[model samples]
Target: MVAYDGTDFSGFQVQPDQVTIQGEIEAALHRLTGETIQISGSGRTDAGVHARGQVFHFDTKSGIPLDKWRFVLNNQLPDSIVIRSVEEVSSEFHARFDVKVKEYRYCIDNGAVPDVFRHRYADHIRSPLDVEAMRQAARHLVGRHDFTSFCSAKTVVEDKVRTVYDVRVESEGQVIWVICRGNGFLYNMVRIIVGTLVEVGQGKRHPDELRTILLGRNRELAGKTAPAKGLTMWEVSYEE
Candidate 1:
């Protein structure tokens, strides 16, 4: 599956009575295939979290030819979601387990006032942010460590150690984009990281303080969780 704005939907997962993206997509798949199939996604994005290149997989006994899979699925799916491509692979291929890395991008609009058009897509900050300071702080996060401080308290994962491959911050006009690539992320991890970086940009926290936060491994010592609307899953990769 490709990415979506996810603003109009409840969330990525199917719920009892809510209009979720996954529920709609799976319903469409059932309409086309006449099979009650279960889809597995790389991650379960929150209600407002968006994605540009999300991936999912499902099994079918319909025996539809691989070349025609996209055509069939697209016809039944809504306009909000698009099936970019389809291919046949071994049944053992798991979308989440085979994923080698995931990348996310957070957008911040640094202007005196917010734009109505971008309200649903980017975060608007009234105060001026020090871009250089944020960039320096971002560098400190690009390494392997136990990121307990950056994650939300609701995360149930047993292991907190994760490797961050890269972090880049750039500004264009009033928009600042923070891009991060990692092996895996804990719940609300990227949003908290961005929140901390924003504090660093505002001179409320020092760049080196990230090390202390990580060492402390205490969620209370971290910055507040950034809004989910500004975060987008940029891409996902799997190893051969």
Candidate 2:
């Protein structure tokens, strides 16, 4: 697994001409292991979608050993991506299949202007937001439910029902954080949820409106999708 700020790269997946985090990682792995390994990630993130605990796996023919995997890989990887740790597990321990939960966080700069440095990591909203309203709206999103309204219309997944264990909103000075943990998420699900919650915070929508939208199951009835730069894959869990 690794964590990275994808602002400087094209995306997580490997592309033919464009430079990507996955491409760099595969290149490094090939160079070190002398095998053409196929890397499999938990999911493909769009360009500029940052991750704090992205998981990936690849089969290696070389017997370089497990303890040195992190040191060997990190030595060749760019500073933008950091390999946190590595451990040998059963062959059945899949990165995507054996996962328990995933968490994401979206940051908002609720202020007059955005900071130049923090602009890439947080969305800047000029209007004053009602934090309490946002929190109340988020409560409706918790628990197992069909979240078709919160996902992107282009999502091709057949199943839309997902278990959202928690959704929380909090403000610390100028920063507003929207955090969500779920068993699985559809494409752009977190961004849309944040957008709707932001509408509730701005008093443009009522807290109860979230329930209506969920029941409607219409993407058109939901709020606009928020920007990707503010969103981060915060964590992933697995059963020990």
- Residue-level lDDT of model 2, residues 21-111, one tens digit each, is 8998999999998888877777777787888898988777789988999999999999888999887767787888877899899999997
What is the lDDT, from 0 to 100, of the residue 224 in candidate 1? 89
Q: Number of the top candidate by TM-score?
A: 2
- What's the lDDT for residue 3 in model 2? 91
What would the TM-scores of all predictions be? 0.95, 0.95
Backbone collision count in every prediction?
A: 0, 0
Best by lDDT: 2
Tens digits of per-residue lDDT for model 1 on 1-240? 576787888888999988887898889888887889889988888888888888898888887888998888888877777778786768999888889999999999998988778798899988999989998888878899999999998889989999999988889888899899999999999999999999998999998888899889989989989999999998999962
